[model samples]
Target: MEHIVNMKSLTTEEMMKIIELAREMKADGIRKLDRTYYVSNLFFEPSTRTKSSFEMAERRLGMEVIPFAPESSSTLKGESLYDTVKTFEAIGLDLVVIRHPRDKYYEQLVDHMDIPLINGGDGSGQHPTQSLLDIFTIYEHFGQFEGLNVTIAGDISHSRVAKSNAESLKRLGANVTFVCPEEWAGEFDYTTDLDAQIENCDVLMLLRVQHERHDGEGLAFSKWEYHRQFGLTLERAERLQKHAIIMHPAPVNRGVEIADELIESPQSKILTQVENGVYVRAAIIKLLLKGRNE
Candidate 1:
């Protein structure tokens, strides 16, 4: 519980504790912390949801958020990640949340820092908080994870969401499946067909096709073709089970990962996932700060 770095390192009890706490906070509004603490967010990549969600979470807990922008900071002058973090620690900040483009970027900081570090994201590596919120959203709907069939579809090779959720969902006793183009499957076993998974899955979790990570390479298929083949078209949406839910770790390419019409569909939990992120993150901060005091 020292660093909220990755899902693989968390025990089932710890994950459940965070989820339950998030649910409680969602039911009863967040209560401010007894003492104000200071935090900073260091995002080296562009973000909307995670950055804003963490800010909302910190404010809800009555924590002071120190604003930081890398372009304006010492990083432009070649300050190392470790050096930057040390600077923040020297400033007496209580905690830090970081999202960097490099994978496992927190590794170097974790051993050297005294303050807790919450990873917002690392390059296609892990997004533990996003995974927790996603888990919280699913639990909110179904009341459990055991034996649930979760199908994760899209850019598996480049999605931190897919990686984090796949490991966590399996650990929590859910049967997990990956659907993606063969080249995008990465190290996981996967099926190319989304249709076959539609009827059985309790959660159809779609990931954005991370074109930014493709290193200037062009997609083999056009958007229409990708949508027809892999995206959740209205035709395919008809096949989902009665109790099944649709999800996306979005910044959704409306016609790419899923149809535009389904974004607000009755079965879609995309917006709920975003809303739950605030409470889930608040719970994480509360627990981590509480753990620090003890």
Candidate 2:
């Protein structure tokens, strides 16, 4: 029943070490073939990057990837999450990757099972894998997060991205700042009174407001004000540290969270983040499996 729940299992060094290994696995050139190892992804909600990356990770490592999309799974037919998990466990899956809208969903399941859990995300609580990929991308680009001023903007309250990013960045030596409308700012509920949380950082990490997740949460706001107050506009982008980089964990809310202009800027690393994500996930799977025997 052991598991990697949120960032608790990773210190800055261990996390970076995993990401670096993931990179090497991705670059191995020769694809190994092993159809015996089974990995299951049990995600209750929708995700493109996460599911795909996990799928690619297993495939690249020669493991069998169980069907990932929730819509295509038996859970859509009134099966409780626990029942679904048990079914997968019964089938002797080697690893489980889960994402659910409720925080602690996997931890509760882990309490009952013999399998290992890799939490894709649990509501707005945390997305550790994404955080690792983000740090890896930044480290690969700049070689360091320390002394860098990095800003995470948008839907801070309900964004696992912002929460994990802030913690992950700081743990890795970056000075982190968060920007969002007061309602959706970082989960911390307080900023240190710096302008745009942009005073002196090397990067700006923009987060997308989950429009669908906010529908009933009462955190939704008009698109105009959203972009006006927090987005990276032409003028706003001009104010960054001369060498600052722009980052976003994508499925970006283009016109709303970031102006159309900044997405294509020389500083933008949105696509790069996506690419590195697959590599990092592959690395994690390899690391976990390789070390399972020890």
Candidate 3:
């Protein structure tokens, strides 16, 4: 069975194939999978877009989805994650999509389970599916990843999306730049000037300020200060290249990562990203299932 733990697990060809499949799926508006598999969604962290989109994808593909609620389930009663996953396997669930708050948490479960394990988001580790959908969205607009100037701004250290995207985009031939405060910048091609990046980038991807993951000492700057320094304000949006676009993995920290008006602007591809997520996830599940059969 094939488990999508991170973007690194996938080759460039494989990523391209998945994006092609996603595009095909979107254009056809049809689910082409056999619909014989059952999948479980085990999310230990809170989510709005990824969780719902995955469920919608499963439903569209005609697969049985067993949503796992860790809060109310045996996990609350102190059942181990391993045990909870094992129980699902025992109940005949064919695969598991997990979102946890620990880095590389999926690694621990993949070997212990018989079914395929998909990483939804493993706490500040990697969000491969998000990156896949992001690439699909970028492709839909820009037609290709090669030579595209893509800027990822804000909260880099705690962003799984940024980590996965930087790796995948670079591999796909996009010039990836990370823009953030010095503390958050970690061994990347980084810049502190958001305006300079916006002027040059074909795609400007903004990440939310991950206050949830902060150690209280980091991101010490005020929201207004952060906005002044790095946020995608109206002024910055106006200066974007004629063909440039903005993107965010939602649950946006409104004024921190981007202004509310900018999110609804003509240059914003945020909603498109959400919509493409469903198709991309559907394609991923179908491909994984096909791999199992082959």
Candidate 4:
């Protein structure tokens, strides 16, 4: 079965096709898809954008959805993701949208199931769909990713959104940069190995860290100081390429990673990203649920 766990897992053509389909679906009307489907949202962590978007996407397509929250579901029974996936399989689920707080979180489930799996996110390391919708959403504004300068600032080592965006931008030849401190930088961090990857970048994306997501105060640095060093200050954000865009996956820490002013600025594509997320997810479901036996 096919799965979407990361951006690098898809060819450029495949990625574009999905985004194009999303736009087409948005233009036409979601109710036009003829199918009865059930999608399982197996989110092990808290998420509003991803959860609600996927839910609405399914509804717009005239499909049914089953959701799992840590507090409201059998996950509280200490069910493993493996077992949960099996249960969904037994129930005849068409697809599963999964997320967790571990890096490469879906690696273990890749071969365990027969249905297509759409990875909502795996920890902070690879939210592939978010990055895809991000590019598609930006295209509505800038036309294409070429020559776009996208700077990703914040927890470079952990942000799957940042990781996937860096690769997506690079694959499309957009200049991408990592703006985190040296202590948390890496080859995949978009800073050290990809200096040439960022020059003349056309967009700057910021990632915010939640207090609960951090291990302890000594893990890296205090939240106040993290903001001081790498957070996207208004001045720093303005220094980007003139037409550069600002994007963030929400639940932002105001005044911490991203200044509130920039989030509300015209240059920010944050809200559009959230909106496109629904369309993209609906498109993904169309792909996976199509040709299924009624």
Candidate 5:
């Protein structure tokens, strides 16, 4: 509870507590803290949803968000991540949220820092907040996780979302399946057939291909081919059960990861996931700060 670093480190009870708090906050609406807290975000990687969602969460909680640009920071002078974090600690900030490209980047800062650190993301390591929001969305729809069939498809090797969600969902008593091409499977056992799992799964979670992480190598098939085979084409989406939901942690590739029309379809919870992110993150910050004070 000290730092929201990895989903694997959280107990089932702890995870549920965050989800419950988020749900309550969503129902009750924003309630600013009696005292103001100052926070800063250090994202070394490119983002849209995660970064903005955290800022929204911080603002809603009445925390003063200190904006940061990695390009203009001391990092440009070769200052280390540890030094930069230490600098923030010295600046009297209450907490810091960081998203760095190095996997497990917070490992070096967590033990030494005085304030709590909420990991925005770290390489292909884990995205705990995103996982929480995704779980919240799922829980909101179904009211439970036990025995839910969750199939995650796409660039599993390079996705922090896939890694975080797979573990957390399985731990919460959901049956989790991974679908990806062999080259993108990474450490998990997976099948290349999205079609086979589509009808049976209660959740079809698509992922972006993450071309940036593929180094200089190109896919053997074109984007259209990938979409036809693995992506959620209109035909594939029709095969989903009525109760089934589609989700993507997006900056969506539109037609690349899913059919463009399906992004806002009735069964798609993609935007709801984004909306819930702010609440889930607010709950996390509240819990971490509450724990720190006690």
Candidate 6:
């Protein structure tokens, strides 16, 4: 069984193939994927975009989705994750999508499951599916990944999206840079001067202040200071290249991470990312099922 647990586990060719499939799926519009298979979601963490988008993707692909609500599930009664997953497997689910709040949490379940386990998000670890959809969105806009300067800003230390995007984009030959406060920005290609780097980069990807993780204490800066220094304010937005694009993994922090006005602007690809997410996820689900058949 093939599981998308990490972006680094996929080759550049494989990643590109998924993007190509997503583009085709988008162009082709609605279509049946498989009628017999069932997909399940077990999200231990709270989600709005990823959860809803994955469910939408499953429905579009003709799969009967069993969304496991952890709040009301046996897990709430102190049932072990292993038992819950085993119960699902015993009942004959074809695949499972898990989102846990513990880093490298899939280690406990991956070895035992007969079916594939796709990591929707695993705490401070990588979010491979998000990275794949991000790559698709970037490729759709630029037609290629090579030589594109992609700068990811905000909450780098706690962002699974930043880590996955950095690893995947660099493997595909895009120059990846992290912009954040000195405390959060470590050895990677990093910058504190967001304004200086704004004009040259082809993509300015901003991340949310993940308060849920570490109570948003990654940096000591106040909201105003952080916005003034790193947030994409109106003045900073004007400095972006004509063809540059802005992207964020949704439920944006608004004025704290990015200016509220830029959320709906032409240069912002936030909505486009949300739209492409369904197609990319559909492609991923289709690929994993196809491999099992083969």
Q: Estimate each model's TM-score.
A: 0.99, 0.89, 0.96, 0.88, 0.99, 0.96
lDDT of 5 at 37: 98
- Tell me how far candidate 5 lies from the true structure as C-alpha RMSD in angstroms: 0.6
Q: Which has the better lDDT: candidate 3, or candidate 6? A: 3
Cα lDDT tens digits, model 4, 1-294, are 178899988888878888898998778877646657777788878889998998999888877787666787676888877888988989988888898887787888887878889899887678888988988887777888787667777767667787788778788877766776675565653453223433365666777674565565444666666666666667666566667677888878888877778888877888888999998988877776663433
lDDT of 3 by residue, 1-294 (tens): 288999999999999999999999999985646656788899999999999999999889888888678878989888888888899999998778999899998776877777888899988889999999999999999898899999999989889999999999999999998999988886666789988887889999999988888867656778999998999988898889999999999889888889988888888999999999999998898888888778
lDDT of each: 0.94, 0.76, 0.89, 0.76, 0.94, 0.88
- Candidates 1 and 6 compared: the better one by lDDT is 1
In angstroms, how far off is 260's CA in candidate 2?
1.4
Cα lDDT of candidate 3 equals 0.89
Question: Taking the tens digit of each residue's C-alpha lDDT, what string does model 6 give over 17-100?
Answer: 899989998998857864668889999988888888999998888889986888899998999988998999999898889999
**lDDT digits (tens) for residues 105-221 of candidate 2:** 875587787667788999989998899888888888798777877777777888888878777787777877666666665447556233546546577887887866776765455
Name every residue pair that clashes in candidate 3.
none
lDDT of 4: 0.76
Model 6 ranges with Cα > 4 A deviation: 186-189, 215-219
Name the regions of candidate 4 deviating beyond 4 angstroms: 189-200, 218-225, 237-241, 291-294
Q: Lowest-scoring 10 consecutive residues by lDDT in candidate 6?
A: 212-221
Off by over 4 Å in 3: none
Candidate with more favorable, higher lDDT: 4 or 5: 5
Q: For model 4, state the Cα shift of residue 294 in Å.
A: 13
Q: In model 5, what is the error at residue 114, expressed in angstroms?
A: 0.8
- TM-score-wise, the better of 3 and 5 is 5
